[model samples]
Target: MKNDFTLEVYSENAFSVLNRMINIFNRRRIRIRSLLATELEADYKHGMASFKLHTTAEQLERAMHQLEKLIEVERVVRIN
Candidate 1:
């Protein structure tokens, strides 16, 4: 089943983090439809990294798990 997820990533530079994310996606052989990482409007206390992704439910869950393992990643959620 296809699933759309909004994952809020807390990392330093969105650019570097995105590279790692892309590597993971390539390793997993999952194609990303669209991804956006924007700085949070709040202060630095919130960290500031957000992304939206569209993929299969299984792929999404697996990707989330992998992302959680990365030290740069603080948290992840499957938003509605």
Candidate 2:
């Protein structure tokens, strides 16, 4: 079953990494409901990208795993 999710992805150069992460969802045919990307701190060395997605739990787990595999992605958190 599909459900709504709030996901936060922390990474380096969050803006740049957005494309790659979006591509993962695109390939899966999952639509992104909303997105917010910004540097986590003033240093710009780290960033956080938040997204609202509608998808099955299985797909969510797979996507999170793939996101973690990314070189720039520091971690992924499911807020809800």
Q: Pick the candidate with the highest TM-score.
A: 2
Model 1 TM-score relative to the real fold: 0.66
lDDT of each: 0.67, 0.91
- lDDT of candidate 2 at residue 2, scale 0 to 100: 95
Model 2, stretches more than 4 Å misplaced? Answer: none
lDDT of 2 by residue, 1-80 (tens): 99999899999984558899999999998779999988878788898889999999999999999999999998899999
Candidate 1 lDDT for residue 22? 68
Can you write out model 1's per-residue Cα lDDT over 1-80, one digit (the tens) per residue?
66666766666554467688667777887766666666654654334344556668788788879988877777776665
lDDT of 1: 0.67
| TM-score against native, each model | 0.66, 0.93
lDDT for model 2: 0.91
**Candidate 1 wrongly placed segments (more than 4 Å):** 41-50
